[model samples]
Target: MTLVEGSGCFVVTDEGVRLMDLVGGIAVNALGHCHPEVVEAASAQMRRLLHTSNLYYTTPQVELAEALVASAFPGRVFWCNSGAEANEAAIKVARKWGRLHRRGAFTVVTLEGAFHGRTLATLAATGNAHYSDPFRPLPEGFRQVPRGDLAAVERALVDPDRPGVAVLAEPIQGESGVNPLGTEYLVGLRELCDRHRALLILDEVQTGMGRTGTMWAHQAAGIVPDLMTAAKGLGGGLPLGAVLVSKTADCLEPGDHGSTFGGNPVACAAGLAAISVITRDRLFNRAAIAGDQLKEGILGFRAMGLPVADVRGSGLLLGIGLSEPWARELAGVALQEGLLINPIGAATIRLAPPLVISDDEIELALEGLRSSLVRVMRDKGL
Candidate 1:
């Protein structure tokens, strides 16, 4: 019998062993697993109303929409069920915006290492070929380019034949080991997109909702995208997503898109509660401070002879680069030491603990990492 009841940063396994959750349910548990407020909101809403189709409106749904639009990147909000749906809606808006305004340019440009989502359209938009190669004949008009190379993006934008190309990007490539796009490069891409009449779409599904210190990651660049997608933390573990569209791309007509369970009342209730907690409690600042602490701690470990190459990120969304491909082994060691963390790739370990994580938790996680690194290095004969 597997035990399945747990909450907050500590989880109890079936055997009754308690474990610290540093991954925060892969960044979805923003308020931590089954936060009391969120759980109460969801339960209360579920009892009142669960589903109310597009024909009707509910308070929770309306409140969530208002909250999302209020924090949006100068755009209107469209709700959905997950990150993939949000990306899909963003793609539709980009395509439609291009078709109507640019007279039939259908190409949407994305950067390599970007992880948009897993839906057919989003999987096509994702720049990673490993995810795309499995299913060939992907959706058309998604142009893949190297990330942070403004000159390459400029070339693609200037190609007159690709008239309707829209540049879709993640400010920081979270899934590809947390590679941050340079501020200069992002600004340059914005200018290029504007100059070439291409719509700029930011895939903020992982980086938005205060994950990167700011309310939104692209705020660092001071550029507003024509479209943006958010999901992971927006609902705070309630399974909700949204696509924000700029006024210019408000071309979505009735019946253009619809979802039966996109904005469920229960999910919206959870979203509203989560947003209230995040904004009122000031978790964004907490994430920034924790991020700085984590970075400094990791850097200190390097100074102590751990062969750490780089530690780059903003807020709580951080990635540690190793001198060798030992992230998996290191993660294994950390797990054995009673920490919950994940490897982004062969050489990178991604850290996205909850925004409400305590200072002690952060230090303990870092200590676990330091010890794991020492053990893995010795085991690997490094």
Candidate 2:
């Protein structure tokens, strides 16, 4: 659909159809569309300055960095333009940190089903053949192991031939259908990384900024990653990303890396406003409550003999598993029914609604989803 404008939890199409935007720009619109605070912040920053490159320090950039570090841990922040760039920064930090600290060990061990980014190095870190096959000759020094398998991770990290200098992972895998690695597994990962002396890198690109019911998803496990990357909803729909560097893992020098539009003044301004709203209003808790509402609602469909089999992930980042392989069809029907949802492959529907979504909007989403499900069932003669 050709979206023309957006307000709150809904978007208007060129045809004037007001559809509930459960997709939330794929989880980028933290405060919903056209949030006045974000608009004013960006406008105010534009009036003062727009782009100064990274050569000079802008107030928004410095303040945003300070805010991110304050929220995550006691460390520094590296600004970037997207999730891929953030992950790329983390990868560079890992490699440099390995050289300086891990006897030149360079391999970064990632879990299977993880989605880091599309850059060559991050793609190599992702270890997805479909995404990496066409882009052959991917960067080396990356290994993949079974998700949630601490034994496998320990084995890879201690591989004497080419030891892993870091362990990179998502607290909950999003693009691969919202597979949560569990608190026990995450805590185990931290322990393994510590025992092996490997930097723990948590890719919070899709799960950060209150998307997963917390400031950062790793907080749920009570583990602090040596390096953390954040994006998606960070800029309140503006293009911005950041890498939070821990005190021990802060290894990048002045000339090690840079980005032209990494921390644009306007983007940082919007991000600061977004973060302020999330923190002051405690939208993370709202996300948790809304997520529970949505999850319970979908699961309730199962009792009525609908296709819903399970709900995965936490907070707004949810994956609805269907008992049948009709996710694509269901998504199409859902769109026609005035709901916007993402379908992962054939059996899972992804929901990443705005944190500001109201209970009534959620009910609308559930109603639309139910209608779509019934239509799909009827059409398929189920």
> Quick one: best TM-score, which candidate?
2
In model 1, the Cα lDDT at residue 302 comes to 76
* Segments of candidate 1 deviating more than 4 angstroms: 1-3
Local distance difference test, per candidate?
Answer: 0.84, 0.93
For residues 163-206, could you state the per-residue lDDT of candidate 1 as single tens digits? 54689889988899888896888898889988988888888888
TM-score of each: 0.96, 0.99
**Which pairs of residues have clashing backbones in candidate 2?**
none
Error of 1 at 92 (Å): 0.8
TM-score result, candidate 1:
0.96
In candidate 2, what are the lDDT values of residues 152-208, reduced to their tens digit? 999999999999999999999999999998999999999999998999999998999
Provide the RMSD of all predictions against the true structure, rounded to 1 decimal.
1.6, 0.7
Clashes of each: 1, 0
